[model samples]
Target: MLKVQEIREIIKLVDQSSINEFTYETNGTKVSMKKAAENVVVQSQPVVQVEKEVTAVQPTQATAQPVQQEVKETVEPTAKESTVNFDHEITSPMVGTFYAAPNPESDPYVSVGSKVNKDTVVCIVEAMKLFNEIEAEVSGKIVEILVENGELVEYGQPLFRVKTK
Candidate 1:
């Protein structure tokens, strides 16, 4: 099994290189990555083994289950949704884990109803073990938090909705 750090390293190398596709398989685990325009799609497959038993009275069958995993880098919001009231939304700049606070024990940078400026650090997005402080690019009041703390956020995913002053 590949560690999280190893997987991240692979992704980073693939993204920086000019290669369009890459694959690795070892010990029943397969990791495949493909570059699409500006985004890199990663997929993993894990092998499963099953055992069957047979007897004179009855027979049993064994089946192998398929494992599939997909990572989506971007999500586009639909125009039909009812988010027009907000003047601005604080969006994540990368695919990573969203952190509302600097650390586990600290208070969140901002919450619903909190006033913010153009440069206020609204949240942190941790990618590849790097903590990036995301700023509220517009002066406004936080009206909604679109994502929960510790949630996996995709690139350009909205983190907060703000009503500009």
Candidate 2:
């Protein structure tokens, strides 16, 4: 697997070049990158066996190097108002792309402070071209969203923190 810094460098080079698509393969690791609108999209496929980890990094052209901090895993909200104490956490049942809203033009199904019931569809996880609606098993208010839109999420990872009252 390529280091985060290496990936950022590739993204920078691609953005500067006129070519629309760039592919890099080395040591059984293949990474394909493309530019869409103002966003740099990267996809990786590792043929070597390694620990399972899914990371979604959004590269911005403001600087030569993309900020590595943006590549993060599930993060718990640190703000006091968004903090939850042993509250219900909605986890991903399977690995897929996390979509907060049904479509790009529509509002998200749920956001911070949004009220939800057991059957409410909080988000959709798309795997293998199939969109799966992930429901909130416990009814409560959504305190925080752990993943960004279009980010790849892993199985059993926390997607949202629900504050059950």
Candidate 2 segments exceeding 4 Å error: 1-82
Model 1 ranges off by over 4 Å: 1-84
User: What would the C-alpha RMSD of candidate 1 be, to one decimal place?
Assistant: 13.9
Mind giving the per-residue lDDT tens digits that candidate 1 earns over 1-165?
Answer: 778887887688667655577765555677888999999999987644444443332333574544444443433332225544788878889877778999999999998899999999999988777889999989989998987777666577788999999
Top candidate, metric lDDT: 1
Tens-digit lDDT track of model 2 for 64-119: 66534432344333223544553899999986678999999999999999999999
- The root-mean-square deviation over C-alpha atoms between each candidate and the true structure, in angstroms, is 13.9, 16.4
What TM-score fits each model?
A: 0.52, 0.52
